[model samples]
Every structure is written in structure tokens, then in C-alpha cells.
Target: MIGGIVGIDQDIVKADVTPQVDTANTDISTNYIATSNDYGKIGGENGSDWTIDSNGVLRIQSGTWNDESVAKFWSSLKSDDGSNINAGNKITSVIFEGNIITGNSLASLFDSLENLKSVTVALGAKFDTSKTEDFQNMFSNDSSLESIDMHMFNWENVTSSLSMFYQTGLKSVDMTNINAPKLSDASSMFYNCKSLKSAKFDGTNFSKDGVKLPQFLASCSDLADVSLQNSFTGKITDTSLMFDGDINLEDLDVSSMNLSSDTKTSFMFQTSNNVQDIRRKSITLPADPNITNSKIDEYNTDRYKGWSSNLSGDIVPSLETYYSNNANVGKTTWTLVEKDKSQYKVNYIDQDGNLIETKNESGIIGNPINTTKILGYSDPKNSESQPDLMSIADNNDQEFNIVLKKLAPYKVKIDVEYGDGHPSESFSVDIPYGLTSSSAQVDQSILDKLASNDSLDLDKSKAFIQRIASGNPATEGDGFSLSTVISGFNIDGSDFKSIFNGTIDFVNEQVDSAILEGASGQTFDAFEIYFDKYEQSESHNNGGSTVSKEITDINQKSATFGDKETKLYNSNGVLIPNIQLAKNSDWKNDKQMILDGTKYYRVSTDAWVKASDVYVYTDNISKIRVHADNRSRIIRPNGDLSDRALEKSTEWKTDRYTTINGEKYYRVSTEGFVKASEVSEYK
Candidate 1:
């Protein structure tokens, strides 16, 4: 066995015998029989060099060999010798390649290879398992075999798989490689492969008569992932304990299974407590499954959602069907607010996850734009209408409009001189439309900016600017306070002249909250207004004037009307535009007087006046009116203070006069006299 004599492992007295290993592989090795079906005796106690050590691993040359030779090599392990070789106990791994297996059944080929950790079936290696039905103990008790790549091994016509892979040390196995088209009886096929984690079998293999899978993977605690739909579609009926002990299975999606006609599914998932979801919640039932001795009652939740059958024995959906049935029950509500041009309009939830119909860009009220409020959807832009002018007018979309439509209903009010704890500074109140208050009480609609903790409406934040500018009523809820959202839409120092201060900042603020979807009518509380003062332009007490002054203070001859009524006298000694009053001969000299408890002033002998009703001026003339009973107070148009009654019967003419709060008086010639309502040209 030295170098001088060719080594026992390499002795080749004959010529080279090379053959094709597979379609594309040629046997170039000098030792292996290069042809298939050589059937030479392989491993045994005899002269055959093939031998599995006490460790049970067949140590062969690391190269491709003929399948027939490999088969013979394996068969020798179970040869009819008076002494049984340690075939089952010692052969742990096989490293051989061949295709001659097409002539034989590999039923117990590697069954007892208890320590066999892995097997690499060579290319073109086909097992003629078509005619043979039994595959009992195929790789049984191979505890050390971690995996076997049988992709090249075909089992197209195999029918049975009892104890096929029982007690193996495999990690994951895809039995789809073994195309068992006629496989029906698969009981205990993978029983107790404790180390097995996943088992994926081909569905086509079980297309034949259904395969009974009772206790097939029983007690395989670590086998969490399983896939065997072939049995459901085939003629295999009895599946009593298919996954009887798969305790840690997380989810099982069986929606693809068509178990339309099965006889028994009792205890299919018996004691497998941890298995959670079994989808396609229902399994088919036979027209008449004999469950007299079965545990069908235990098949309710531990396995499928529910297993039920009436007189017709058809399986019905389980309670999990609720999800598959109710699709719209949880629809969310929200508005898709886009800048419609110059203003903002809220496209509220109108239909399935979409906004209501809206007038198109055309004033003609074109097809309503169904706004999308879907989570993953982006609203279409003006891009929908190609080549159309980006113009808002060319488009009825009113953001481009000088006047807003949707936000027009809302408002903001600016009440000046807000004197709280501060130094009586002026502030603005940005309230919703229809909100009323006192002060300048200007009582008029004013566009004011808000600055406070008011939230930007969740969905309406997108275009809150337009909403505020147009005074859209936040009537729905306590609308968003423009203050908090705006921060500063244009408050110069303290002047709130514009809502464009934090234009970009505010838009960023609403971008997130505004687009968030909501429940059907969810609303925000009132937008508590906040204010930024513009250097306190003007301040005072409770929005009132800081200083009080009358016109008389500026001009000695002019004064605001006082509280009392007054009278005047005419130099002509006759009362014109006559009215009834307490007449007396008052000679004159007094420009102010008091009658009873009120103050008064006399402009002429025929004219008497209430202090508050008279606006004094050096030469100012106001048209007088005869309201109710006009007392006797006559006067010449010039300037007079007398107690003579005005002659209402005399037809006096006036050249010019002024009206106050609608009441009018006239100057007649060089004398004063009649109420415009009661004289010529007065009306």
C-alpha cells in the first residue's frame, strides 16, 4: 500500500471508464464506475470498499458516482449477511451521486442512517417510486441528519408516506421536491421531527385522491411553520390530527385551501394551544362524515374559526367572518383643503373616502371634482386639465377670486383700545363669523388677525389663511384660533394689519393637523383668539376714548348740544314757522340757558333749543324741524336769543339749511324761521 504499489483506494488495473454523470456533466474521475446500472456490490462486510464508520457516515470519494453503484452501495448496508452491519447505527452522511435509482424503490434506502446528517442527491438521480406505494421509515430515526437536498429525486407517482421523515434532525424541508401526485396515505409522515421548523410541501403532489394526514406532524413542538395544501385538494379525507401538537405556530393563512369534500377533520389542531390565526376560516365538510367516534366538537377554535355542518354538512364561516363582511363600517371623515386659488374652500367628506363634488375651474359649474381624502392618495392638481390656463378665472376654483366663497361666511373683529391689566392698548379680536361684541362696536364686519391658543382645524389647516381672510365661519366647532396658528400673520410690533405675518409658518403648522382624517363629525373647540399689538397705536379705557373733548373747547362760538331745550326771539316781533312753547319777553344777551332741570340755549326770539340738540357755531346754520308740538320761540335768521314764540302760521322762506340725523331747518330771507318739513323747498 506504499507509493511503490498504487494505493488500495486508487488501484486501477483496467482502462478508464468515463460516462456522463448527467446531461451536462461527464465523469472525469478515474475511480468511479462511469456508467449507470453498474449494480456492482457496494458497502458490506465483504471486499466491497464502501463502509460507514462507527460514527455512521459513509466516507466515499468526494465526487459524482453512478446511481446504480450508489444504490448498490446503500443496499449493501442491509445485505442478507448473518451479521447485520451497523447500517442504521453508523451511516450518518452519504456523499455520492447517481441516476440509476430509476429502476428501484428507495423506500428504506437511508432509513436507519441514525447519524446521517445530510444527503446530496446528485443530478439525474431519479427514484422509480411511481410503482412502489410504501415509503415507511424513509429517513426515520436519522437524528443527526440536518438536511437532505432531494430536489433531483422525483416521487411523481408515490402513494404512501408512513413514517417518511419520522424523528429526523432536519431544520426545514420543502417536500415539494418529491412530487407525490398519487400520495394519499400520509399518516405520521413527519411525526416528531422535533428540530424541524418549517415544512413546505408542493400542492400538485397531493392532487390525486385526498391524502389522510392524521397525526402527520404530531409532537413536533418546534415545527412552527407548516404548508400542506395538496392534502386539502386531493382525495385525502381523514385529517384528524394533522397539526395535533404544533404549539407555537403564529399564523396559518389557509385561504388558498379548497377542502370542499373531507370526511373527518376532528381534532385537526388538537392541543396546539398557541396556534393563533387559521384564515379562510372554514374547511369543507363531507356530506356525511361519520363523527360518531370523532372529536369534532373540539375543532371549534383551537383549529379553524369554527367547524359546523347542518343536514347538508357544509362548513360555514366562523365569527372571524365579521372582518371579511363589513368593509365600510369604519370609514373616516376629513376635509381635503387645497388652496383653491386666492381663497380656500373646504372639500368635506362627501362619499367613500372622497370629498363632495365641486365646481370645476369653469364658471359654468363643470363636473364636480371628487376630492380624494384617502390616506395614501394625493389630491390631483390643476394638472388634471392639461394646457388650461393656470388662471383661477379660467378656473372657477376661487382661490384666484378677489372675493372668497367658502370663507366668506366667517369673520374677525378688531376692537380698538383693549384695556385689560395692560396700559390700555388697542387689540384685535379674530372671532368667527356672526360673532358680535361691543365697542367701536364699530359693530361692523372687520377682518382681524387672531393670535392665541386656537388650534388650526385638523383638516382645514391646509388653507386656514384663506379661511381666516375670507372670514369663513368656524361655525362647526370652536374654530381654530388664528393667533396660535398664525403666530404672526402680520402684526407689526402690535399692528394687526394683515393675516400674512406667519404665512409660511402658519401653513406649515396646519399642514400636519389639517390633513389628518377624523371621525364623522369631529370638531375643534372655538379658536381662542390671541393678539399682537402694534406699538399700541392707540389706547384707552375699555375701547373708549382716552380723553374726552367737545367742539366748544376748540371754538368759543361752537359747542355740542346740551341736555335741555332752549328758545329764541325774533327782532321783527313776529313768530315765523310758528310752534307752541312757553312764550315770554326775553330781551336777549344769553347764548346759554337752563329750563327746569335741563340746560338750554337760545338762538333767536322765536327759536328755543335743547342744549344737546344744538350744535353751536359762529355762523353755522342747521335746518330745524317741527317735531310734535313746536313751542313759541321766534327768531330772525341772523343771531338771536328770545322767548317769543315762532309763528308757525307765517310762510317763511329759507335759503340754506343743514339737517342733523334727518331733521332739517331753513333760513328765510334775512331772518331764520321754518322747519324744512313744514316750509317751501324743505322736502
Candidate 2:
């Protein structure tokens, strides 16, 4: 009467029954009990030992069981109280701890155990059957066993699995870790396991050749999932009635099965009508001449039924064309048969082969590719003809390329600047391709200023821009401008016209300051205008010494050297040798000349200076009176004072003036000049 909790528990003694020992057991150092009311012996004499607790838990501790029918031994067991006991009903669980349980077979090991529910191989121990070759009926007829932890089982040497879990109450079985490379039989392995909902064998190794699998999962009416992914690597000899009554299976993937020419596949999927999807690597029908197309049709119509078929590998005779030759033969209607479409991507690239955008597409073999136009871009080669079809016959990802060039013009920024830190006027214009200014609407004021300076060569500056726009090499300083200058641009180093399309700041360094005009904020400058006029001097006979009185020109300009010392130039606008002017020096000039777009003032008969380097004032002085000291000594051309002097309090007519040591000297006589300190204006 084994009515209690069904697991391992300590046997609390209400009473004790003496253990009986056989006379054949000679080892007195250990208590080798043959039978008892509290426990029973599992291992034979000279083998290992076991015990059954009051909770009906059989604990086999550190031992081996001789290869024999363990179920039959349990049916005929007797207790040490000299009474017959039903071990099957009393044993509810078996716990193996610390040892080897080897045998030639595991057939009927736990068969028909009406109350057996669990078998646990403890951690740090294994149920080793390394020498066994059979697993027939291993857990057969165990209608109460819902699960088994066989993770620690060593089944490397097994060769058969016939009816292994037949008619069991297994809800799920994960034999993913099983490795039986020599196994050849799994017939009826889980046959009639009506409660099995899932059986996973993802990593199991069943590599034996010509393996038999007839009725493997037949009659499993509740079977919903059976995963055998990549578990088969052999030629199957038989698959008849493999899933005969598995009406709940929705999808079956036998893609790994290798059906040889001599294989038997009769009723392989009999009554599995719920399955809608079937996948296989390819179809390899038997090579026997007697097995005709009619035979295969019968199998599909009466046994293996599938709603859709997904097959891989190339078909020598297409599935539809093969049946076309045999119009009399009836074939199953495969509602959907297809191969996965190959995926590819089209990359839109710039002229320099830089990727801009990508489009992903998919199609079957020989399908033409279509493309769309991108704004502001066009293919230079006009090679935008329809691209080649999807030539790759397999379902692999690939890529293609289409190069495009920009069609829109570059927006260049035009800036008018003054070198004297004045606010710059900026605007943007659409410069055409090739970096040309043909489409540019330059400010008329800027162009007018550029032409106003006779020293500025407008043709040369326009030519410089033309060189860059025509794809010729050009540098920033190569071009000149009176009102606007281009800076920070390099044509050779830029890729894809990037530098040309960016900001092009036109800076006018010539105009240091400007005045706003007409309230439009657009200013213009007329920097130092030059004229072609000449001056004359008259000689007056003073004491018969040919005293040439310098005649004043009403248009004469009074020029003063800038704060910074500057060099004097010849009349031809060339720098005078060793003629540097002191700062704040003053000179009177009536003539001007234009050179390199800059105006120059003629300080002497043969010397000139840039107008930009000095400040000019209107000269209206015509006569001067000598100081009362009367000692107005005359200065020689070599800068020495002469013995001659002007009469005291006498007025004289003068016109020319010169700078000496930054002092003003006026011409009182043609022979020498008088210091400005000794002269006063004659009103």
C-alpha cells in the first residue's frame, strides 16, 4: 500500500524489518541486503546497491545494474518479512547517484510502472550506458511518467531506439544533446505517445547510413511540434507511417533527410492532414524502374499531404513541366510553390564615385531593374538605360552602382569689402557649371569702380576668371581687381567642384573707405583720379642773374607724406633709387600719372609718389613776404644754405615747394629755396 507523497524523503521508522542476506554473499565487511520491507535490492550480488524510501523513492547509490530485465525483477520482488510485495506500485521515482549503470540494452527498464512519474540522475553523476547497443522500450508503457531528466545520460554507444518511448505520457522531450552516430533504427521510437506536444532534437547526431525510421512518431495525435533541424546526415531506408496519426502538426521540415534510390517512403505522412507547409532540400525519387511516376503520385495523394511546397536546388525537369508529359497521371495540387527572391541594392553615386543614396530591391532571376531620377543630378554617360536583369540564380544579396553628375549651377557669394574695416555688402549669384560668371549678375557699382581706376587692367582680371571657368589652373592671387578681389579659392585641389560651389568672397582692398550712395547702401569710390595737364615757369630778369620766378598753377595740389615713411617714385611711376621720403613731409605737385591702377603725384620735375601713400590738399598760395630779420638764406639743391638772402620785409612771387628733413621750403628764387619759417603769405 504505497499511498503517500511521490518523491525522495527520509524513511521515518514506525517499525523495522530485518534485512535478509543470501548465503552466497561472502563479504561481511558490508551489509549486502537481499530484500526488506523498507527497501529493495536493484543491483545483483557483487554489483552495486539501492533503496526504496517510505515515500516510494528508489535511490540507487554508487553502483551498476547487471544487464537484465529490471521490470520483471520488480514484478517478482519479495520483502524480508517473508511477504510478496508489488515493487511497481511502491516505486514512484528513481534517483541515480554517483556511478555506472551499464548494460547491453535499456529495453523495458521502466515499462508498465503504473505509478512511476519521475527519474532523476543527480548532478555530479551520470547514467552511463557506454557499452549498450539498444534502447528498445526504454520507457514504454510508463503512462504516468510525464518527464525525464536524461541530460546526464551517456548514450554515445547506442545503436537502436526501437519503441524507445512508446505509449508514454511524455508532454515534452528535449533530446537536443543526444549523440548516437552509430544508431540505425528509430522505428516506433515515440509511437502512440498521445500526450507528446513537443519533441526537440536540434543538435542530436544521427549520422548512421541507411537508418530506419518507420512509425517513428505515429499515432501521436497531440503532437504539435517536432524539431529535427540538421539532425539527419544519412540515407533513410524507411519512413513508412513515420507520422501516421500526427494530425496536429502544422509544419514539417524534412530538408535534412537524404532519401536514396532504394529508400522506402510508403505512408510517410499518413493522416497528417493538418500540415500546411513542407520544406525539402530537393526531391530524389527512387531510381528503380519499377517505381514509376504513378507510385509517387499515389504517395502524395494518399499519404504525404502538403498545402504548399518550398524546395531548394535546381530542378532538371521543372515540377510543372515534368507532370506535363504525363497528362493521365493525377498530381497533388501544390497551391504555392516558390523559391526565395534574391535581394539586391542599387547605389546612386556622384561623378567621383561617392555614394549618395541606396535603394533595396528584390526579384526572381531575369527580372529587369528600374530606377528613378534624382533632382539636380544627371548621369554623364547617359548610361541610365534599363540596368541588367537579376542574373544571380540564388537567393544571395548583391549590389550595383549608377554614377550621376550635378546638373544645377553653383551658388557663389559676391562680397564687396573695403580694406579699412568697413561693413561689407554681400549677395549670392548662380554661377554656371565650369565655374563661369556668364550667369552672374555682378553689381554695376562694383564694375564701375573697377573701370574707374585706369591703373587696373580689367581685361587681365576677366581673363583670370575665364581660365578657372574653362578648367584651367588658377590661383587666388593670379587675378587683380580695383573694387573686388577673389581670395581663398583653389581649383586643382577641389573634388567634384566643391570648392567652386562654396562661398566666393570678392574683397576690394583698393578702396580703404567708401561713402554710402543714394540711400541704397551700395557705395562707390573714385580713388585718386589722374589728369594729363602740364605746368609752366617764367624767368624774370633779377639783377641780370636770370632769376626764374616759379609760376604757380591754380590747379596745383599740396601733398603730404603719410604717418609712415614712404618711398618716392620717378615720373614713370618706378621707385626712385635711394629716395625715401620722411614721414609728414610736404610737397606741391600740379601733375599726376596713372600706373597699375594707382594714381601718382609728380613732386619734382623727375620724381613722383603714389597718391595712396600721402594726403593731398588744394594749394592756393601765390606770394610770400620775407621776415623782418631780413636774413632769409637761400638753400642749394644739395640741401646747403647759400650766402644770398631775401630783402627784409620784401614780398616776392613764389610757386614751387620742396620737403627737406620733413620741413617745407618754398622757392623764392629760381637759384635756391627759402625755408617756410622765413616766409609769410602776402595777402
Candidate 3:
């Protein structure tokens, strides 16, 4: 079937006589075989007879059918008027009935039948195939025929079944009972049976000596399952191209078959690498050591054949050595690939061994690593520089730490303005990078640096630094300056660096003068650092108690001082230096306390004075009159005086009041407080 041979002998003579049959009914089954006169075959035995019934069933009844007689059976069919008809195309079914014996060559018995659909041995039939030797093209190329039931067939003497069912439309085959002990060649037995889905030959033995099975099931494209059990027990000589193109065959086990010493297994699995499991039980190499060693060398070097043998046991020591040297004897070679870059992480660990940050990147081997600088991190030794990249090890678990050090605060020059008309001086103070909030106090080291400078004559005891509030300091008071005197010299350089160009204000006070009084009705600004000269030493009396009580009733009321510039005193009745209240100036008072046999009231955050210097009111005043020309000043929340002053003889509206050193102060703005001694109610 593979080479398109029709398998008919060319020497057969043609027949001239036609059998008598009805012309109207042209179906081949409705006609019968020719009589003695009508038959014209020139060779073979005459015992076999062919007949067709109305159902298109062709029966070979009780006779011996040889190759030539069977070929003549094709020419014996006729119509009613003795016209030749194609029995191969018209016959729908074939049955071997009664006692029958086939000759040595039963090849091409029903080959190339166009419409033939079925073939079967009838019940109670004694069909014999013990004498048949060549079944080369039997039943080959019958495209429309789907199946056959030949369970009674005994293939005990079949020598060569080459192309027996080639190119047929068979869906499956069961040759388990068809044992061919003498069968040697089965090349192309089921080749190109494209529609065949499965086959079973598990019982059929192919153990005969020197068995040749080339192209046994090659090119069965649709074949999926093939079962074999005791079929391959004998010594196999030639198995080249045995399963050449059975692409859909997934598993094949020829492990039971012991290959002869001179077996030709070249390309046995050619173009069939998809068969995942192939078991070779025990393979015996050639008896000659040179040939066996040469074949072993070829197996090791053969690149054209992609199959790998699963040879479990080797009869020769050379093959055993080869199998032992290569554990994956049939597997492909190893391939190299690049490593993944995402898995290598560079951890930035601090000096305390804490993981501060991490970076994921892979560097090329033997090349300098590319790195970036973190904002506030650096090498421990250098605040301005980062760690060298080459120093970090290149490994997945490598801890790449440069001993991450926090960057030192950089120095920024700020202009210090002394509100006492001194020339503003510039000093450098540290401002850390990426600072979040305002610092509570300037670093003491910065103050020490300023104190050591020879250009500025600042009293280290009185000198303090802080940020200013507005662009015009005289109107808006100080910036967060209450945190300085109430706490320490605080710095909020965030907005000040851009808005005020790093400018700070410093005011000098006359702390040595005693009773520094203002003119009559002269309103004064609340003092910043009210007791700049007093250190609150242990020598000062506490009047039997250290803690002061809250005077909630008259806490925010106004107090009118005496006509003379009222003198202020401390909690111990000691006269305070450089501070006094103007005569008749209305002041707001807060807390009142008795100390050292004298009653004093606190008018600011730190300042307190004798209660006799002012007359405290029961109710808070809404307006205050400025009596001093330019002495009236606005004080910060921390009791520091700002540069602003109230106009003389001007009446200012007051929202609320608080007491500082027994002198009441009224709130004229957000944080500016004017002392009651500097202002009185305008009438």
C-alpha cells in the first residue's frame, strides 16, 4: 500500500463471456456468479465459488481459494445481459462461510475495495490460514472499510505480514490470539493507518530468531494506544525505523525483547521523541569487542538521533561502563542563563546594626557598582560623603552597610539684631537638613561658639537666640519666643531661612539700674526676661512657703498705679532693678501672692511686684491709655519685650489682660501685651 502496487498478477487472461442477470436491477449483490460456460478464468483450483445475495453480501462458500483464483473472482461478476460490473465497488459485506482453506499467498484478497465496509468469518465456519505465508497486501487501501473480525485466523505460519493493513480505515486491531511463532518480518504492518486509534498484540509472540521489524507502525498519525505483552520476548535483529512517525504514541515498552548481538537499532525511535517511557530490559551488544565498543562510541557521539535509551542491564562491560559514567545517558546537555537581578538586595544598616533602608539592584560581575545617596545617611566617618560602592559585597545575602551615619547639621549664618540700636551681627548656627519641627532650643554648642567670638561683646549670662515672627518685628512681636524664656532660646529656622534671610533679634536690657521708672501716665511694654538679673537663689526668703496660690478672681483685671512712677519689687520685697510703672497708667493684673511680709502680684510670665504700687480693679478694662512717648512696648508670651511701642496720649482697645510683676497688661494684638503701668483707661 505504501508504494501503490495493485498486487495482482499481470499474466491473468481476460474473460469474454457475460453471466445472465436482470438489467433493471444493477446492484452487484442482486446478481449471482457465472456458470461453467460463463466463467473464463484460465488458472487456479475450481473448488472455490463466489456468490452475492440481495443485501450486497459476498460469501465465499466451501472451497479452496488461492491468490490467482481470488484475483479472477474480481472478473467473474456480470449483469443480467452478461456485461462486466465492478464487484469491488458494489460489494458491501464479505463473509467466509462453511469449510474453507486459503493457499500460501492470500495477498491482495480484498485490496482497493471502494465501497466494501465489513469482513467477517461466519459462525460455524472452519476457515484455515495455517498454510498462508505472505499476507503482504491483504485488505490494503480499502478506504471505506472500517473493521474486520478475524478472531478465528491462526497466523502460526505467517512469515512476512508487510503492509498487511497499510493505509486502511481501521479504528482498532486485536491480534492477541494471532500468534506467529515463525513470523520474522512485520515491516509496515500498520503503516499510515491514519484513522486507527488503537491496537492490541499483547499475546502475539515475535520471539523467532533474526526477526526483522523495520517501519512496523510508521506514520500512523492518529494512533494513540498500542499494547504489547508477550509479543517481543525473542531476540530481535533489526528494529530500525520501527516507530518512525507514530507521533501520538505516548508510551512504548519493548523492555522484554532481548536484542541480538548484531541488532541494527539505528533510528528506531526517529522523529518520535514524544514517547516518554521506553524500557529496554537487557540489551546485548555485538559479540566482537571492537564492534561493541564502536557502537558504544557511536551512542556517546551520535547527535542526529535525539532518542535516549533506557537500557537497564548490559551484557557487556563496555556498555555497563558507559551507563555508569553517564547517569542521564539520554538527556540533553545543560544550558547556562543569567541570574535574576531583583533577588540581590543591598541593605543600608546603621552603626547600631539596625536596618535603616534597603535597595534592590544587581551589579555586573567584576564592575564598579552604581549606587545613590540617601538624604540623611552617609559613611560614619564622612558626613558630607556617601560610602564607596566597591566596598559593598555583591551577594544575595550580603549585608552592605557603610556604617550609616546621620549627617551633621550644617551651619547657616543668621543676622542678630539688638533692638537697642546695636549693629546687627552675623553668627553661624547649625540647621539640620530635612528638619520637621521647630527646635526647642538652639544647641548649647552654638551659643558657646558665639560667646567665644571676639567681634561681639555679648554677655554670656544674658545672651539668648530665637527666631522672629514677621518681616516687620516692631508690629508682629517675636516668633515662638515664649518657648525661649519660658523654656529656652528656641529656633524655627524653617520659614525664617527663606522669609527673613536667617535674621534673629536680640534686645539688651539695663539690668543694673534700680527703679528705672517711666514718666507720668507713660505706658510701658511688658518686660521680656523680667528678672534678668535675679537668679532665684536659696538666700531669698519664700515667706514660709515656696509654691504660689492661684488668684482666679482678679487674675485678668486692670490695676491703676500711683501718680509717681511706681517702683516694682520681687517676691521677697527686694527692689527690682531697671523696671518701674508710670503714674496713673492703667495696668492689668493677674495672680497675687504674699511674700516676705508684703503682697505682690504677677503681671507677666516671670515679673512680680509689690501690690501697693497699683490699685487692682474688680473688673477687666476694655481700653487703655498710653502715657509714655515711646516707652510703651509689646511683650512676647515669654515676657520678652518686642520693638513695638504705643503712641503717647493714645487710647488703645484691649481685648483681655494678664498680670506681670503686679502690673496688669492688656492684649492689644495676637501676642503683644502692653503693661498696665504704660497705659491707663482714657476718660
| TM per candidate | 0.33, 0.38, 0.37
Estimate, for each residue in 1-683, the C-alpha lDDT of model 3 and write its tens digit: 01211122221111121112222343444455333234532225545565655566776666765555354255345777887777666667777665688877776777777667877666666678888887777777877766665455557787877787788887777666456788888878877877776777666675467578777777776665677656666667777776666655545545444444466766565544443322111223222211122222212111112222334322233443454455433321111122222124556666677877676544434333445444345533342224343432445564444555555543434445443454544555543322222122233333322322223312211212221111121333333333233233333321222112122222112111111111112222222221112112124326665643322213334444333576776644567788876654556665555443355677665567666656443333345667532347777434667788777667666655655533457766645667775576521
Local distance difference test values of all predictions, in order: 0.40, 0.52, 0.50
Better of 1 and 2 by lDDT: 2
Task: Give candidate 3's error at residue 514 in angstroms.
Answer: 99
- Where does candidate 2 stray beyond 4 Å? 1-40, 79-84, 272-683
What is the Cα-based TM-score of model 3? Answer: 0.37
Please state the error at residue 298 of candidate 1 in Å. 6.2
lDDT by residue (423-499, candidate 1, tens digit) is 43233332222111111122211222222112213222222344333223343333434444444344332212233
Q: After superposition, how far is residue 10 of candidate 2 from its true place, in Å?
A: 33
